[model samples]
Target: MMAQGKAIAVRRERVDESVSGQRIDNYLLRICKGVPKSHVYRILRSGEVRVNGGRVGPTYRLAEGDEVRIPPVRLAEPVASGPTPAGKPLPVIYEDDALIVVDKPSGKAVHGGSGVSYGVIEQLRSQRPEARMLELAHRIDRETSGLLIIAKRRPALTALHDMMREGRVQKRYLTLVAGRWPNPLQHIKEPLFKYLTPEGERRVRVSSDGKASHSIVRLVRRWARFSLLEVELMTGRTHQIRVHLAHVGFPLCGDDKYGDFALNKALEAEGLKRMFLHAAQLGFVHPLSGERIALQSELPDELRVFLDHLDRTEPQKHG
Candidate 1:
């Protein structure tokens, strides 16, 4: 039976030969790392799980060539405090009759509600009471700071949304991640998925069966044990860069969800606070002019200080 809004579904996957010696529950827990072990066992008991197209016991051994099917059920989670208004003012990057561009600060949401009293858009309205209508042209993570385009009118919002669906807009980010990259520039064509945990937190990872996510990464500079990276997203998914980078073994600095906590602490000690991801550039067509516009935001002060430390500790590569 499916939930009211859901289309009843069963996800089937084959057990890899390497996992031949594991317990069924262990195998399930390993593949779905963010889920609870008890939940995996519960599914086993519920008769919602099958192996080799047959029902299996909790302690059943997972053999090399078994097909596993899992029934679908929506996991419940409390909504995150949606975007809320901020007392701090915003820096406008670009503004026209159709839309207003902003270099949004971190710790703010693009949209309002869920649990938040006010988001960036709402706060913008509070400050600029003259504005008539507002809508988000695109969205970035709440923890991420930089280039956000807001439509000031409904028609403009429609036009921007249409362009985004057609993949006409481009975004670029600046970030710092663990370890040094062998290549100065490279592209990662990895697939990604967001695995929801029982605690209502989120984990991102690379998966064989996942949404296609592509990023072009460039090693801008390196410190004693870290690297500054420039990332241009070819396809967008939740936490795409953070997930792909972590899967490649170099999580972003200060990204608690998809980062190394120990390293984050060390960076924090150095006063390299906040997640290293920053939306640096945005390019899109004008809604009315039919002309293209590219906008950029300078690296924030914190990132600059971190860069300073890198320059002092590591050999600089001059272009």
Candidate 2:
């Protein structure tokens, strides 16, 4: 445990196989309990943190046997506000020695930070203290509900990352958008640039200088004023699905960012309280077994109820 209220001397750690391939920023965040994320990045930017006697970027992946030099920083003492919330067990979709997949609910973050005290990963770690290793294979937005993958071992995590990078993993989402989709199927290829607002809130936009992004959208159902779409991401970028859909003039229902504000307000009043996006399906090969793995999560009751309401009141144009 880290001692609070005083700066400790710098320490050096040698990477082992268990921790190999983890990003430097994430490694620091895990080890440096109570340290603010901004401070961690500050130290990284200032060259205070080093790997093998040289400065490394935050995204640098650790290799086995690499020596990491962690600088000293003071951590604030814990305040006894109340008892820490117990880690509630999430709905498990699948689990094995290699990984665990869970049905993550909408509005819960995958990991804790930036004003969130605990999230799905932290909750899972708290629940399974006996487990040797647990790490996120990928991430979905806090407001996006659906299947999430957590690796039980480092090798599995590394393998899963490679598979995703190679586009061997297929991810599909179900979302309700504002407007009638013209085509039965359409491919949206747009570049997305991420930037902070004047107040430092992260936001992504379609820009010429942004990284390439692609989404294949298939219309599932259409109402007089809304359309349900199945979106398959060809490239995983931040807010890829939301931004791409919104950029094409069909903002996702209840999406606060990059959404129709007036429609969102009306949606909240009509019982569509959260973003209408669900990670409905995932298909990939098992990292350890080399067997195929396919998983699906049905839309949550709330989202389904909203759709039912739409069907009851709105005229259906397509199905």
Candidate 3:
């Protein structure tokens, strides 16, 4: 147990297999009970926290057998705030010995951090503490609700990563955007660069010196002011769908980061509170078995309700 209000002496710990691949800052945050987030970053930036006698960035991934030096600081009083909370569990889409797929709802982060105490991964871990290994296979934005894959074993996780890199995994999303989609079938190839805003918020933009991204968008339907689209991602990049659509002049409805501000305000007045993006389907071969598998999740009730409202109020528009 962490001693509250007592200054801890500096200690060194060797990374083991269990902690390999986790970010250093996250590991510190978990162990340093009651320490403020700013302090963690401050220690990191000051080089007081060293890995193998050298300063490492916050995002540095830990490796097995790496020596981590932790400077002692006073621990905060034990607070119940950070413990995993009980709530409605995410709906399970598919489960096997190697993996588990769940339908993650919007507004829930995939993992805890950045002011979120607990998220889908943490909650799942809490719910199944007996399980030896469980990790995220991939991530969907917090506002995007749909099928999320969780690997139950390290081998399974590795297999999924290889599959994603090889483009064997197929993912599809449904979104409603601000303008009519011009093409029945459209392909967007853009380069995206990620950067932090002045306020420390992460953002992405199209840049010449950026990573290559590709998205295939098919028009699903059209309304008076918005068009529903089915987006198939060819290259997975940060904010690929949102950024691509915004660059193409069809920003996603209710997208706070890369959306139209005035239109978003109008949309809120019309009762659409969340981003209109859903990971509707995922297809990949089984990691353990060679069989092909496809999982799907229907639109959440709120999105469905908003779509119904649009259908009732806005007549279908012909391009």
Candidate 4:
């Protein structure tokens, strides 16, 4: 651990392979111990921190062999806490030297921040203290459940990120949406813009001046008032699937952010207390092994039971 107390003299660090490809902001957060995130950003904005003898933005990705100048900063002593309680191990879908895939449950954030005290990554780290490196390869919405990847090594993380950007990773989600879907197969290409609301809530919407996004929707099943769809994401954007479906007038069943609010309330009474989105499948080539990898996760019992209820109460439609 770095020293925690009065401000220390500036120091330089040589980026190693272990941390290569990580964002500079994230790197500072890790090594600065108890330094405030705001302080870190302040220094970056003021050019107090430099990389390779030049100032870089917070989003800059560090490469191996890069030299970093860390400015002097005071850090508060970490608060003493009681012995950490053992955390429940996440369900492992697959694991190797390079990466691990786990079945993430709905309602749990992938990592801690904002109002979340701790999240999946924190719990996993607590469970595997001996691991040298563990970082999220990708993220899913907190209300979305399914296969989530965590890279065990820095090289694998970089490779996985590249694969996602190049559209080599195939991600599929199962969702129950309001109203019947008309087409058996449809491609939705919408430009999405992300913005913050007046109250400071982050949101995304379909807009003309936004980045191009694509989703392939396949009707899996249908009921009188609800449709089950398998959506394959071609471009990963914030709230891409939810925003796209909702923009097409088929909001996800329990999506509070973009769905029908009144319908969601009734859904809670009907026992579908959470969003009906599940990351059902992921297919990609192994980042380091040169082998193909495919993983799947089953829908949670609540979603399944809700479907059964619909079958018993609502009229069936051809799927």
TM-score of each: 0.69, 0.84, 0.79, 0.87
> Candidate 2: which stretches are off by over 4 Å?
1-17, 23-29, 32-76
Tell me the number of clashing residue pairs for each predicted model: 5, 0, 0, 0
After TM-score superposition, the amount by which residue 162's alpha carbon in candidate 3 deviates from its true location, in angstroms, is 1.7
Q: What clash count does candidate 3 reach?
A: 0
Which residue pairs show backbone clashes in model 4? none
Worst 10 residues of 2 by lDDT: 79-88
Model 3 Cα lDDT, one tens digit per residue, 1-319? 8644668899899987656777899889877868889999999999999999999999999888999999987776665667657578779999988899999999999998888878899999889989766789999898989989999876678788889887789999999999878899999999999999999988999999889889999999999889999999888888999999999899999999999989999989998999999999999889879889988889899999999999999989986
lDDT of 1 by residue, 145-249 (tens): 999998875556767778776667788999998887668888998888778789867677788788888889988877667888899888878899898888888
Q: Is candidate 2 or candidate 3 better by TM-score?
A: 2
Error of 1 at 60 (Å): 51
Model 4 lDDT per residue over 1-319, tens place: 7544777789899998878888999999998978889999999999999999999999999999999999999987656787565467889999998898999989999999878878999888888989878899999999999999999889999999999998999999999999999999999999999999999888999999899999999999999899999999999999999999999999999999999999999989988999999999999999888999989999888889999999899999785
Winner on TM-score (3 vs 4):
4
Task: Name the lDDT value of residue 302 in candidate 4.
Answer: 85
Summing lDDT over every window of 10 consecutive residues in candidate 4, give the lowest-scoring window: 77-86
Spell out the clash pairs found in candidate 1: 83-119, 84-118, 84-119, 85-118, 85-119
**Model 3 — which ten-residue stretch has the worst lDDT?**
77-86
